[model samples]
Target: MVLTDTHTHQYYETDPVKKAELMQRCLDNGISRLFLPNVDSTSISQVMDMVDTYPDNCFPMLGLHPCDVKANWKQELETIYAAIKETKVYAIGEIGIDLYWDQTFLAEQQQAFRQQIGWAKAAKLPINIHCRNAFDEVYAILKDEHNQELRGIFHCFSGTLEQARQIIDLNFMLGIGGVVTYKNAGLDKVVEHIGLNSIVLETDSPYLTPVPYRGKPNESSYLIHVAQKIADLHQTTLETVARITTENSKIIFGI
Candidate 1:
């Protein structure tokens, strides 16, 4: 089964040597395609460098992350817009409202989110949302602006079934990942009810590693475990899970 890691962070530089080794490990393990999300203005060059290094394997998206929104958000958005105009990014991503870590920049975050959504619409590219502890706020913005024209994936989706339905209604696919393997995580239930087509596979690497490797650093190779868990939850085979999710990814990313 060919696995597509729909989301990953191969750009963050902990150690170039170790990062290269990790990328090789993922490639060796059948992780052929990797989609990267921009963290902030500071990381755009790093993300672009990775994409340049492996243009065929790594696809990068341009956007400002919600957590990075600050008083200088206007400048950040300008930089992001300029990057979008200069590059052929696959999507406008990792942008949304997040009240989980901090709320000081709530208003700024919302404004940045809305602006990036407009940028996506104008660029004719899909969006990759990063919603956390601000579902209602995120949903409200999407509900107001989302139409048949705007579409993308809700990266690391961990919402209720009703929320899943609403996201689907907005023409976005749910990104399923390592969290689904957690015993207490309700994503298995979401998968059971929503099926595989409404979802796509991701690792969100170096963050949400699957069980057995739960507390460890995640890599694209770990996506196989995520796929296996979803297959088990849906009472299907891993090959089927891989096939359907990969197809769903191709459709969303136009790869």
Candidate 2:
């Protein structure tokens, strides 16, 4: 029952005691590997600290999140790019365009996304995308930039079967997370059309907590629920989902 949380953000919890307890909970729940995605330059240190504390369990990524893109996005990207060159990051991610909250920086977000994609290609790393209300924009960039050298996951995917197929066609995996367990999220229906090989599990923790703990803060320990939900949707067992998705994660993250 080895589970891998392909996407989670645990850098915000600064308390050492709380961090140790959280790591214990993850281990107890059989979540042995946790991939931490960077939000922006501000989050780099915290992410590095977490990875340092649990070198065996946690891995880090380097990127500037779409929502974090602003007038100074170029400077922010420079910081992330420098980190990518210096640090041992697993992916270039948690990056993409988000128009749901603000459309003011859409162009800037797209450039940041593509620039990061170039970095990932040059560095031979996968990407962890965070798309929200900008699938068309993201897909357009992917279509133009993707090649044999490009690969990654559509993190926290909650789209239609058509979109899922499109992502798969581009050689990217669908990152299924807590949203699949939502009462009316429609992700289960999407899952029915796609095989487990095209999917990977994530928690997006500190957000999108799975059922039975919907209102509470999400943690890596809750990944079992997401895996269970996918198992139920596919009419398969939890062990199968865990094994396949963990393998799919290794394919993407190379860990």
Candidate 3:
């Protein structure tokens, strides 16, 4: 079975030996397709370097993460916007509002989110959004920017049924990750309510590791536990979950 980690940050490893070892673990686990999201100017090189090293297995996404939004966001976006043209950007992503950490850059985050949405639409690329404690703000921007050409995954979605419906109504897929495996995350109910078609799987690795590995650094290789958890939640099989979610990832990334 082929599992696609629609949102993962495998580029965090700089050592060639460690990187290869980690990627081999993912490949052996059948988590073959790794889509890496960009955080800012600082992350592009690492992500792109991984993409270069594993051209087929690893892919790059270009965008300024919400938490990285600062007073110099305009400059960062400009730098990101320029780089998208020079490389093959799989998506415009990991972008959205984040009030959980700091609200000082709320306005700038909103502006950056909107601008990146425009970039995604113009480039005809899907987006992998990162939202936290600012769903209302993120939803508002999405509503305003809604269009036939606008589509992507709501990365690491941990919201209510109403929010899930609203996201699906926007023709976007919900990116289910290790959060679903948490004992009290309540994402199983959300998954059951949304059905499989509107869902995709992710690890958001180096974070949100699944049960049995919780509290440790997450790896794409541990994705099988996540798929198994979703299968248990849906009363389906791991193969079924893998097949469906992998197809959903292919559709969104156009791979």
lDDT of each: 0.89, 0.93, 0.92
Best by lDDT: 2
Q: Report, for all candidates in order, the number of backbone clashes.
A: 0, 0, 0
Please tell me which model should have the higher lDDT, number 1 or number 2. 2
How displaced is residue 94 in candidate 3, in Å? Answer: 1.1
TM-score of each: 0.97, 0.99, 0.98
**lDDT tens digits, residue span 71-101, model 1:** 8899988988898889889989889999999
lDDT of 2 by residue, 1-255 (tens): 799999999778899999999989999989999999989998999999999999999999889999999999999988888888888999998899999999999989988998999889988999999999989999999999989979999999999999999999999999999999998989888987889999999999899999989999999999999999888888999999999999999999889
Model 2's TM-score against the true structure: 0.99
How would you encode candidate 3's per-residue C-alpha lDDT over 63-134 as one tens digit per residue? 999999998999999999999989888899889999998999999999999999989988899988999999
Judged by lDDT relative to the true structure, which candidate is superior, 1 or 3? 3
RMSD of each: 1.2, 0.7, 0.8
Off by over 4 Å in 3: none
So what's the TM-score on candidate 3?
0.98
